[model samples]
Target: MVKDLHGKNIIITGASGGIGEKMARLCAERGANLALVARRTDKLAAMKEELEQRYSIDIYTFSLDVSNMEKVEEVFPLILERFKVIDVLVNNAGYGIFTYAHDADMKEVKSMFDVNVLGLIACTQQVLPKMLATKSGHIINIASQAGKIATPKSSTYSATKHAVLGYSNSLRMEVASQGVYITTVNPGPIETNFFDIADKEGTYVKNVQRYMLKPEYVARKVVDVMLTPTREVNLPRWMNLGSKVFAIAPRLFEWAGRGVFNKK
Candidate 1:
């Protein structure tokens, strides 16, 4: 079982919308003080106001683009000053760009990685020292099922998520002795604006929308993990199992995925 999270200060990146926003609300409802980070100041401000009125908890919103390493360095200390000690770190800021490697724009791919991988790493590094000093904390990364299995037209996005899984897994072991926990939340298909963020044209967007899962389901599981000491949490267990199965048999998985796409 995990310890209680009541009164704990938590930091959630990309909290302006989608999964991040949902997670923020869920955490607040559970009595966690929050430092919400996202590039959208207006959205965060509105959320902060709503949560404060509804929950009567302290909420701080920072307009930050986690992909900017320099900005991250500058903003983290300010976050610490406001929260005093961050008990949980949620690296939930990311998006997808569905395109084959050969045809995908390198700049777009870089942006995805900057937010998905480097941003996660930079934020984690900044929070680690404090967590280590206190000998307690949770690092929950919002990874994707695509990270565990290859998918057509999402090669670059998949690669970066795979890196996240690998990085999180390794870091978990490295910090186990220190009483700090690292977990990767592999969500199959959260019904969020992720597809829209992909900025895909043509039939690709329509095809991707068919497998959407509600973001609340993902957010609920994140709360479950924070309240407990699970090393990893995979939403909609069947899909998680399928990701593992497909990883072992790429051709068959590709064939099935293609068929699914064709049907849509």
Candidate 2:
């Protein structure tokens, strides 16, 4: 277990709001120095001021769209220049749009993959060489339970998460020989503005409102997991059990979970 986060330099993308924001606050409370990245400059600035006031550790803010590969490359160097070697990388920048595959906008589909998949890949590639050189590091990708249990109306979103899972799994093994640790967080629906757009109709959120995980709960779990590296983390154990069932018996799950799984 890693325990204390004091002075650990961590980089968290999508830190302006939602789960990313919650993770940033928690890490700061634990004494980790942070580089908060997001496109919302104003929000980032406000968050930085608040966090800096509460914690003595360094909190740097960067405003950039994670999908922009060039900007990520450029800003990341500056962050490293400021914070030195990044002890932890949190790939939490992602978005989703719920719609049937046939009716989905091609542009929206591409954006999801760009931010959720390629953006994550770009950031990881930028950090890996340094982590490998030091022989110590941790990478946490904020995936979704949608990745493990794909269903109707979220096919594209789920596809991107599946890609995250596949990449994280392979990368973890590849870097296992070194000291780098990779953890994929697969959380069920989280209470955030994400659903405002992800489910503009509000149908899914309404149906599963009771089961949605709190952002703080999810964030704390992610920060704690950094202490003890694990292959994967499926949040809110009850949801994880559903994912496990789907993994073990797909046909059975499909037959039994027709209504429940279709909630999303």
TM-scores of all models? 0.93, 0.97
Question: How well does model 1 score by local distance difference test?
Answer: 0.85
What is the alpha-carbon lDDT for the whole of candidate 2? Answer: 0.91
lDDT of 1 at 70: 96
The list of candidate 2 runs beyond 4 A from truth reads none
CA lDDT, every model vs. true structure: 0.85, 0.91
Identify the candidate with maximal lDDT.
2
lDDT of 2 at 175: 93
Instruction: For residues 88-198, write the lDDT of model 1, one tens digit per residue.
Output: 999999998877679988899899999999999999999999989989888999998878876667789889999999999999999989988898998876666776656
lDDT score, candidate 1, position 212: 63
Give the number of the best model, judged by TM-score.
Answer: 2
Residue-pair clashes, model 1: 2
Per-residue error for 158 in candidate 1, Å, reads 0.1
